[model samples]
Target chain A: MNRHTDTPAGTELLDLPMPEPRTCPFGPAPVYDRLRAEAPVTRVACPTGLTAWLVSRYADVRDVLGDAERFSSRPGQVVHLMAHADPERPIGEGEFTRMDGPEYQRFRRHMGPEISSPRRLAKLRPLVRAVVDERIGALAAAGPPADLYQDFAIPVTTASIGGLVGVPYADRDLFHTAASGVFSDVTDQVQLAAAVRPLQGYLFELVRRRRVEPEDDALSRMVARAPSAEPPFSDVELVAMSAVMLVAGFDSTATALAHGVLALLNDPGQWARLRDDPSLVPGTVEEMVRLFGGGAGIVREATVDTEIGGRPVAKGDYVILAIQSANHDPEAFPDPGRLDVARDTEGHLGFGHGTHQCFGQQTARLELTVALEALVRRVPSLRLAAPLADVPFKTGTSVVGPERVPVTWDEILPAEGEGP
Target chain B: MRVRADTALCVSTGSCALTAPEVFDLGEDDGVVVVLVESPPDEQRETVGRAVRACPAGVLSLAP
Candidate 1:
């Protein structure tokens, strides 16, 4: 939805939507299947007029993502939801995801130790479980037929992220609102502005508060490190980092939880299997990550001319790695459409493959595991309130899934402290 | 199976330690790879292989 101002004259390019539209709720857009088979490395246009070689074969996708030097992790390649920042300026330090080489490693040295540290995640598990229980309790109290997407999935993810990043309890609404606006549509200018402007002001204020008073949370840990570190982290950079934690991390897990639950409810045997055997939760979470990778494409720009799946890709050509399609590739995943919760889903590009793979993937797996285990345990007879076709899905965006899931249950289980 | 990890290459994604804690761990100071057991039991081999494959940095390995 950017202005598409850079379109070149002469030849035409296909302006395919990044997430595209899904013919089946459970699979990626059908076009990807054909693209993988017919033209695994084919050119497609982004909203910004950059023509990219959309790579669909699992092996090619893996190679492109895994080779950091050959394929750069620059920022412009993203099929972005938010309005673009100035493209001319140098990528400041601490903007780690888009950075490559030593600069990327520098941020990782500071952040990797904090966010996914063994000690931090141990404390995080119970907090996430508590959030899951609280949301489920509220959902049960509200209705036998409840809207899971709005009422359950969104709140749980928003609250957990708020707690993870040390955002105050009162400001979680602002976080949730901004996430909703950005995920809904890129074309809607009013919603885009509302999502962007307020969050910037609020994050700066939050960072200032963390400066004076550090807490046992990810942001505070970074802030505590900032003052002592070499070439210290600027407050603006900290704000940008926090925004990514809240907003980028927000919808990924929510959609996984929402879509996983929705899909499970539709498959009664699978739902019952999970409820009966809690030990399967880990593998089920992996399956959820596989099917609902939460992204359609993860883009990269080639550093030099290279061949992918036998097709020649030119230097500076953007390669759109189809994460969702790669997960469903028959070469990688046998019986790709079938949801086998116990399937060996390792090496799937669900969290992405390498270099810039998801920093919070382990936490996301833990979150999905705890949430799914709790839901299946608390509401054994849970089922969908509406038909699968009737459900509204998020389209034309990176993090894609069902927007709303109306669910119903026969009986709700009480919280541990509450009487049966 | 003998598990090997290169801490210098470890980015601390924690996939190895989380998947096969019996074989690997993260350093308390810097959160890099730390191998707990060089040769794991036959019972531990499967998870250890998973740990090796799951390491984002491709630093974890095992002797055949």
Candidate 2:
């Protein structure tokens, strides 16, 4: 049957096409581009046998995200063919991303104290900076003609996630392998689950350890609050939350840093401005977040059939909230194609909008700021080692970033008076 | 006239503090949100708004 065809009232539902991969490595998706231009909200078939309303306009996407009552995050609402296969199991209890209402709030509460307050984030800044410096130092020492993604991005991400999860640095290789398996797209559902289960097991063990001996990290604090009295999360919940934090914390920053560096090298004006004034690092980081557009959309499922943007969405429809696309909508951002570090980007949806916005944003910001600052300061002459298009990008997944970004720069030695 | 933050809603992403440090400041201890200036200088309006828009939370606002 021809899918996705009806308005909220009676207008014929236009079959919206997908857009080119604006941020993905797999070239452009014209279906979405057509929809964005012609039908702000249109219906389309998902990979699964269901149809969904695609909200492309900036304002509409924001409206949907802000009004969670209309849109629910429950896993059962829409079948995430990729998330789970059995339909019976459907992921796990710690899948907080799929939670709504009081459940979401409670899970968020557990995480709130960990990342929300600036003081907690400040404690993380030094560690993040050290990771950034270590990665950059390794890259610099390796000399030019190095893929920044491998030498810098991977190491920093590994270190940052390990530090946050209170894992020893020595254990990072195991965690990194587990992470790759969980997030890998090449693998089938069972394989992916196999990868995730082990990591989940590790996190549960970590939570159990923290319960007995509270440490100075997020895990301990979470366990200390769990004390088997309050709205307590089980051992599984704690571990799942930690795993989520680790994955979300590490992947997003690494992707953004890898892409952000490439974007800066391509645009010399921004690089010069940032190089000249190190103070702009933080603001520049925000602008970069807006521009990278990784994991371009957040999928939301309608709890009941509802009218959205004048389109009739069936109950359990997959509503793709195109955060990255909206951020670049012409109406919200004039000439959205341009990347201006100093632009007034107060409305961009990079970290998302409303209650479900990223909890680790503050930490993400600190990490990116430090990484960028160190990069520009240490490597003034940094440039692409190969043609921009030739750079390989991460493939077949929601999160978009360069898999290998080769960079070259003229070597500059410290002044003779500087300590070696 | 752009780049205003609601003290109650501000989660301290530091977009404002980073965009216009002259106008925004964070608590030293917990980094709870605070305003160094209710109104930023005219010259910084656009950049400040950029800061506001960059906020992950909708805590920042702007004036036309």
DockQ of all predictions against the true structure, Cα-based: 0.55, 0.18
Per-residue lDDT of model 1, residues A1-420, tens digit only: 232232334334555545533456877777777888887776677664455667788899888888888888874335433334222237654567778766665566566656676767788888888998999889777877888887888778778878898886578767667766655535365666677668879988878887788778888878777765556778877777777778776678888898888888878888888888989889988888888683567777778878888877666666788878889899999988778777888788888866577877877877888888888788888899998878998765556889889899888898667788
Q: Pick the candidate with the highest DockQ.
A: 1
Docking class of predicted structure 2: incorrect
| Model 1: colliding residue pairs | none
The TM-score leader among the candidates is 1
